[model samples]
Target: MNLQTKIPLKPNTYNQIDYHSKVLLLGSCFSENIGEKFEYFKFQKLQNPFGILFHPLAIESLITNAINEKEYTKDDIFFHNEQWHCYDSHSKFSNASEIELLQNLNNQIRSTHQFLKEASNVIITLGTAWAYRFIETDEFVANCHKIPQKRFSKELLSVEQITESLEAIMSLVKSINPKVAFIFTVSPVRHIKDGFVDNTQSKSHLIAAIHQVIEPRNHNYYFPSYEIMMDELRDYRFYKEDMLHPNAIAVNYIWERFVQVWISEETKTTMKSVDEIQKGLSHRPFNSQSDAHQTFVKQLEEKKHLLQSNLPHIIF
Candidate 1:
């Protein structure tokens, strides 16, 4: 008997990711998790240039700004708690110097714009439908940045709103890169702070909206990450101690599933080679001067050089 119900994932027959594929991942902390995998595997990827954007509208705003080459001005940012922060970006982009912050934001936009034009796959992981609208600016902020809660009004984006935002994202990105495939997934991280029931409602909205917009025939795909977490690995064992985010095991399991769907079969052997090199680099030799250790190091170096010769973009 099957121990667990698995989400049926089909192998991607076309547009499979390879070492040469340029991937851009945006939205959610989960995007960062998957981006870390891509980084470890040394795939050509750029992830969350503006930082972790959770909602569809926030991601839509980011793409719009990037595609239009929006310039961040003083009015777009505010000095709060002794640091400069943009309402549209995560706190990671906030800086002590206003000029520095603006420079970083604009530079990221320029770089993301250029990358989007050449990206083979654009993966977006929407975290929530809930967003905070700064009442003062009448704008939805990607992150509250620990400002007083009273200053902002919380709102839940309806399915129609999210669908529109998704459509806008696709339209804007496709205008520049017509052939880029879009893969959208709902982040599995539970927002328990929103209250358990409210969190479910928020995820429901995101799921509904994503289904409304995704067209597989158009190369727009939806990966069942949330479903896999809730169904296949439906236990607290898959969660971190906080019981909100997926632990390393769950992340790895989801990643393995993702690889089966998106990564090309021909790249698997290369990935194994890269994995061996990565493991070797991390291995700490108890006897640094021993002949055995020295021989292991030499073998590792040879493997690295061989891999790099074919995929020069991969760097240890």
Candidate 2:
């Protein structure tokens, strides 16, 4: 008997990610999780230049800004709680000095602009449909930056709104990079703080909107990350202690499924070699001067050099 119900995933015939593919991952904390895997494999990838953007609107804004080469100025940033923050970005971009914050934001936009133009695959993971709009400026924020609760009004983005945002993102990205393949996935992290019922509603809107835009024939695809979490790994054992996020085991399982679908078969051997090197690098020697330990270190170095020689972009 089958212990778990598997989600059927078809291998992508076109736009399969290989060692040479330059990938750009945006949106959600889950994107970071998958991005971390890409990093470990030493794939050419750039993830969340503006940090983890959760909603479709925020992601749309990021794409629009990057494609247009938006420059951040003093007016774009505001001083709050003794720190300078941009409403369009995550708190990670905030800085103690306003000039530094603007410089960082503009630099990121320029970098992302270049990356998008050359990216082979663009993976977007939408986290929620819920968003907060700052009442003073009537603008949706990627993050609140811990300002007073009364300063903003929370709103749930309708499916129609999300659909439009997704379309806009597609149009903008395609305009700049016609050859880039798009992969959209809804993040599996539950927003329990939004209330359990509200969380369900938020996810439902995101799913509906994503399906409205994803066209496999056009190289725009959707991966069933949320479904896999809810079905295949349907147990609290797969969750962290908070019972909201997937733990390492669940993440690894999902990542394996992702690899089967998106990663190229030609890169499998190289991936295994990279994995071995990663593990060997993390290994601790029982005896620093032992012959066995020295031999192991030497072998690890050889593997590293071999990989780096082929994929010079890959750095340990």
TM-score of each: 0.98, 0.98
For all candidates in order, the CA lDDT equals 0.94, 0.94
State each model's C-alpha RMSD to the native.
0.9, 1.0
Give candidate 1's TM-score: 0.98
lDDT of 2 by residue, 8-81 (tens): 88788999999989999999999999999999999999999999999989998989999999988988988889
Error of 1 at 294 (Å): 1.6
- Model 2 clashing residue pairs (backbone): none
Give me the displacement of residue 256 in model 1, in angstroms.
0.4
lDDT of 1 by residue, 1-316 (tens): 9899888888988889999999999999999999999999999999999999999989999999999999999989899899999988899999999999999999999999999999999999999999999998798989999999999999999999999999999999999999999999999999988999999999999999999988978989999999999999999999999988999999999999999999988898889998999899999989999999999999999998898998898999
The lowest-lDDT stretch of 10 consecutive residues in candidate 1 is 6-15
